[model samples]
Target: MSLRWKISATVAAVSVVVAVALSLIVHLAYARKQADDAHRLQAERIQLLLREYHRGSQPAFGSRLDDPAVPADLRAAVRGGKVATALRQTSEGTFIWAAAGTGDHVLSLRSDYRDSLGDLAALDRVLLLGSAAVVAGGTLAGIAIGARLSDRLRRAATAARHVSAGDPTVRVGAAIGGRSHDEATELAHAVDAMAGALQARLEAERRVTADIAHELRTPLTGLTTAAELLPPGRMTDIVQERTKALRALVEDVLEVARLDTATERPALSDVALGEFTTHRAAALAPDARVVVRVGTVVATDPRRLERILANLLTNATRHGRPPITVVVDGPRVTVRDRGPGFPGHLLRDGPARFRKGGDRTTPGHGLGLTIAAGQAAVLGARLTFANPREGGALATLDLAPAAGGEPSP
Candidate 1:
């Protein structure tokens, strides 16, 4: 059940329990007080009868008492020169009786308490109705309070979801009703603040990366030209290779920064999945095997798709064992490599730009997967990494379905 309903039910249940308990107590107290008043009236009537009998004015026993209704124990008490009272329930009704002795004969007086019994019954009905009304009102109030709290919680949850989905502009506090200084309001403000802080930090990081990449391009070009002029030696070859790798890294960083800032947009095109995978696999890694089970067409950016595939293949070759497999199934493309799979953290949080995975010994600046992921996002695709049951890292890119009546070939 939802939190709102649970809270409402719990509050309603407690209110009912408390109301029932209090009603029972009040009913019992009122019934006892009424019984006491009835008994006192009965005693007074008995005393009046004894006074009349002792004053030489004998009253009629038939008028004062019902012989059949009076018990034998009450008559014995009156004959023993002691006042006595008893409450009795008969087929006729409920009654309270009192008796006392006057001389040799027993002086007795009895009051039929069935009327007082009826009054107690009426009082019980009133108490029951009032208790039910109290419980109903309390339950409704609880439901209202719970609904209000649930609404605030839902607003906060929605704002959190928006932030997770890359829209940091959503503010839970502003979206909710009048601002109260309650814990829920404070939590909403916290969520908004967190989103703002994250947006600012990511923007700052993107700016720094873009700035560094832009600054390195000119010097890198000069260094490349200078290296070409050097002698064809081992050292020259090493410098050129390192320079090329550095240039590639800088370009990847710039691309990722653009993707982050929404400055990059995909140029969509229809491409045959099977043919595209085969050609890209051949051009990128001819040694790797390409398996196309479902030959279908997809509408996506060919450049971004190629980039994503190329990165996955490169990572497999660099870190994984041989016989890398690339499979294209409809809008899904999976690249599996026979390696120790991905590190636990990388698989969980995805590839972060410049954050190396596995051991630090791996020769990569970790921009390949990051660039691939960012490119996939731009193409409105989902890229997920996992390890298959057969072992090895698996990278799957799910693209949008084919458009323009593109049939499977």
Candidate 2:
């Protein structure tokens, strides 16, 4: 219920109670007055007749009515039965008024109490009917207000859901009241603030991606040309290796840019972990120790998964001894190389971008694990960097499981 309805209902209830009380009191008082007046008029007439009888100087009877101190009119009235001897009874109860002289003679008159009660009853009916009408009207009005309030609240809720479901354009309507204007305005202003923040964040990320692509393309082109000019010897080998590294460098940079912009399309599907590990390990190194836990499949974007695996294998070859081991469980593809594990400090927060300080001391762009972890995250995987107790550093690329099953180990 709205505030207005609550207040109005309270007012109506109190009004009904008060009206009933007032009507009862007024009717009772009026009846009492009428009874008093009727009795007085009857007494006055009786007294006057008795007084006239006394003034005639008739012979005295040895009766109690002859006493001079008694009002003659009252005495005569009592003898002639002009005064009512028995009070008329009423629903309000009967009352008897007697002449003071003797108990036998009573100047009795019915009180107007019944009439007064009848009047009161009539008034009660009127008040009751009126109160009912008032209550009914008030209740209906309260319900109407409640319904309107509920409607407005629903509209606001619907608008909120619409906004949440990728339509930032939904808005609340104006509240039509002088006192409520500020609150409605504040709600609208808050939604505007949220929408503005999302727009700003998206714009900034796009600008960053475009800038990175522009800055690195030229150096990458020169590296490619230089690599092509070398003859096929040790020099050519060096040139070709450098050229391949440069290309990987450019691709890693592009991948990072795409990730930042959320432009990488994730193709989610169930891939058999054992088979995938076998294929990847055979392609990279035939002699590598590849371990496959049976019957584990996961949903992932394959291209991103391949990128992450390649980065880890390459990193392992550079820093670790030969016979790198590849393990596949349901939602995981781990590459562990039998190399001196990463330094403890690096394990916690892996190698920095382009920082060339490791046991291998390889002279090349150092964007391997950084790109691996980033791409794993994009594919909804957990990439853990840890040095194994047995002696090598382990990189576990954990992927999300297929629906309706626990995640694969």
The candidate maximizing lDDT is 1
lDDT of 1 by residue, 260-341 (tens): 8865778888888889999999999989998888777788899889899999999999889887999888888999988999
Residue 240 in candidate 2, Cα distance off native in Å:
3.9
lDDT per residue for candidate 2 within 164-235, as digits (tens), equals 543544554432222354554566557657756874676576577657766777887887787788677998
Model 1, residue pairs in steric clash: none
Show pairs that collide, candidate 2. Answer: 47-73, 50-72, 50-73, 51-73, 320-339
Worst 10 residues of 2 by lDDT: 57-66
The best candidate in terms of TM-score = 1
**Ten-residue segment with the worst summed lDDT in candidate 1?**
60-69
Reference-based lDDT, each prediction: 0.83, 0.64
- Give residue 112's lDDT in candidate 2 (0 to 100): 31
